[model samples]
Target: MEQMTATGVSPKEVRQRADDAGMSILRLDPLNTWSRVWLPDNMDDAYIATVDTRQDRVFALCAELGCRSISLNATFPRGSMSIEAIIEDYAKICAASAFDLDCSLEFIPLWGGRPLAMAWQIVQGAGASNGGLVFDTRHFVRGKSDLADLRTIPGDKIHCVQLNDGPLVLPDGVTTKDDRYDRKFPGDRQFPNVEIVRILSETGGLNQVGAEVFSPMLKDMSAKHVDFARLSGRGAQDSHGNVRKDLFFTRTGSHRPLRFGDGTIHPCLWS
Candidate 1:
């Protein structure tokens, strides 16, 4: 079993650990949540000046620091920021920067039970398909996405796959999204387990499955002791096995997932 540890380490340190562990450090996931929280999505010249100024600084800093890709987990500004504006801004950033956008990961409120693919379309529809998706397991499952959605996707369309877990029971009022991407490691409140891994392997083409966890909890537990390396190792092994199991089941007739109106496939969620 290979292990990658970036405990209390800078990007350089973490990247080194991944390399030493024989793991290819793929996404340099960054937090854009600061934008939605810091400034209004749309702004006049003065506001644009201030925000763009900061944006340029961020690009420069990330490049200088050796961080490559920036993850799009940004929320709306302080109160109510427009999703359209935020997405456009994300696109704009990608356009100006040297960052390699394999594809853009759209941050969304749970649409039904997972991040909205329709919202993802917003990125593609808006011409931001630098590639495909940087899908997150929790966000996808929480959006209530089924495995069938994979059928329509072309093989090379999937960009990156982020691996993490959460609980089935959601927090109060949010029957859909967990609103806690910033939280840490395996066993989240609503992270899809075995099935989540499978969907990516099957539909997403399994380009780059990574352990991109973000939790305040990691501060207390050093890399040497963090969750004792559970999710990335044994947990991943089991999850991968389950994915294979699903494929095995697919060979049978009755166990097949249901079909959408357009004949697109989706899980036959019988809950």
Candidate 2:
């Protein structure tokens, strides 16, 4: 589940809520805040200390919740920061989390780390065994990431797969910012979710798959109005049950069914 869901709640309360709901939080989102790691200001001593405090808080929560991974955004600001510096920071973050959980980099298009290759480069350069990637289908399509590059990634490096769909070709005047807010459920459009899933399955990166819809329509609805089971059912149907067959095993070697539409905005897999 995304950590944002527990915004104002205490870690103990969050865990109790999940327990009451019969849910296990396998991963958390956005290890850092909106401040990009590449920004010069964020590199200051004070900001670095702030970041350390945040990480400590997040790590403490992860330990409390038994969450195994955290999604780290590799957002790049307007000005340039050397790739080496970015990598060093990533390595530091990964190293800090390595003893407890994985640090997966999420690549966003029109922001930074769009193409799969660049995100892979940072992870590779970090050289931390727990460093990994979050494969969001919408970002993958909009980013125009090469399937060849996707094929080259080791399965273990892919920490999560956020499944969502959108137009294969955007209409005129539709910027990525606008388009991102209008995402469709997986298999609702021409997005190549199945093909991507098949490739990830073959490559062994199909560990954790979940729906990540960010539509205004979904946002306006109350929890009771949404039919999570139907949504997950459709995703499985669209994939022809390949998702069920290729479902991932947890670190403890136990198979847990992928529950895409768990009512959480982002349902993740721990493995």
Candidate 3:
């Protein structure tokens, strides 16, 4: 809370800044929860405060913030909850949102929705019109899911995509945290990022593309934050001062990935 207010920045201030720059904000995140994973052991109180906030409260916050989407994911192992029960609960959460909003599910190899197939199953079973899946490239590569799995999904059902890369080699006894920190810039490695984008392109579901490169080493760099002016022109020089234009556009039209400071990435549906 102190950090949020230290710069005297509220959501209103953020919106005003975007307005001043003639840019539109699409999504606000670090807001919603993963349903079952809200109360992991030794979690921070601040995170719990946000995660434990009811769906209705979050909906109200998003409504006031003028963003209609929130980041959501599934729990790992799932403990005792059946998939049916999870879907039922998910539907109720969406129904209680009070506003028409998109609810996207991001699946990770460490979580119950490790595979896109399973995430899609839950979203479909939930039967919520606004429910969809978030296809993150690193997760896709980590899960070892076939690209064909994505090909079958309807373009509209894929709400957004996170574009990133994974290392060609995996360390012994790797873990989820390792997966998070091991992410590479798109095309910086041999993760077939271009092919992933190509598959998404064929599906016509490339509404929002985000470049989320997470690296502990990069975080330690002095130039960790992205420069918006440089980003808008073509490519943003990363912390390592490398030109990363390939992450933004393909053979497709000029598109930009919203690379938030602190190495986070969230992409909203582009009009």
Inter-residue clash pairs, candidate 2: none
Q: Could you tell me the lDDT of residue 231 within candidate 1?
A: 32
> Model 1: per-residue lDDT, tens digit, 167-250?
655667754323454543433334544455555556535554445565555566565443334332333223332222233111
TM-score of each: 0.54, 0.75, 0.75
Compute the lDDT for candidate 3.
Answer: 0.62
Off by over 4 Å in 3: 1-8, 31-38, 41-52, 220-225, 228-271
Clash totals for all candidate models: 20, 0, 0
Query: Candidate 2 — which residues are off by over 4 angstroms?
Result: 1-8, 33-53, 219-227, 230-243, 246-271
Tens-place lDDT per residue, model 3, 179-240, is 67666556556676667666766776665556666666555534323454224423333332
lDDT per residue for candidate 2 within 187-222, as digits (tens), equals: 667677767777887877766666777777765656
